[model samples]
Target: MALSSSSEIVRRPHPLEAAIGDTRVLLDVEQGLYFGLNGIATSIWQRLEQPVRVSDLCCSLKAEYEGEAARIEAEVLAFLALLDARKLIEIRA
Candidate 1:
């Protein structure tokens, strides 16, 4: 799939609490569930603090991870797809 821009994710502190270390932790008050993220996933979330395109995200991941760009891009797309499937993120035109 082609990369697309995504809407900004505004995290509310009231119902969401998160902590990051070796892995990132996300606690959702409404669901009473905690979500964890691997290193690359956590990095992607960190960069998505504002509106950013999928292509840009892949670029950043490659630059920071020192990994193969194409592989990292694919992984990034997959991660983004997972979040999109969960309605955790909004895709913008």
Candidate 2:
């Protein structure tokens, strides 16, 4: 899925999430698959507990880490795409 900063994201309802150390884990009940996320990816997952704009995610991540806006935006979009592909997240324009 093609995504931009303006896109909004929300976690899918069927996944159960848990945190272990610095990593976050998700179980997709229907698919019986496990997904793991670390570091900033975990942060992004946590933020998606509610529907949020990708731009807001970028801003929050930027404040937590030192990086260019464009770079952070790109990485966040990429990670979101991965989760979306796995049916773990819903993306809306």
Model 1 TM-score, all chains together: 0.73
Clash number for candidate 2: 0
Give the number of the best model, judged by TM-score: 2
Q: Which 10 consecutive positions of candidate 2 have the poorest summed lDDT?
A: 1-10
Q: Which stretches of candidate 2 lie over 4 Å from their true place?
A: none
- How many backbone clashes can be found in candidate 1? 0
Looking at candidate 2, what is the lDDT of residue 37? 93
lDDT, candidate 1, at 59 = 74
Predicted candidate 1 versus true structure: per-residue lDDT over 1-93, tens digit per residue: 234434333223343537665877766667686778877787787787777877777777777778887788778777777766554566666
Residue pairs in collision within model 1? none
**Candidate 2 clashing pairs, residues 3+ apart or interchain:** none
- Per-residue lDDT of model 2, residues 1-93, tens digit only: 467889889888968878887778889989999999998888788888899999998999899999999999989988988998999988887
* TM-score, every prediction: 0.73, 0.92
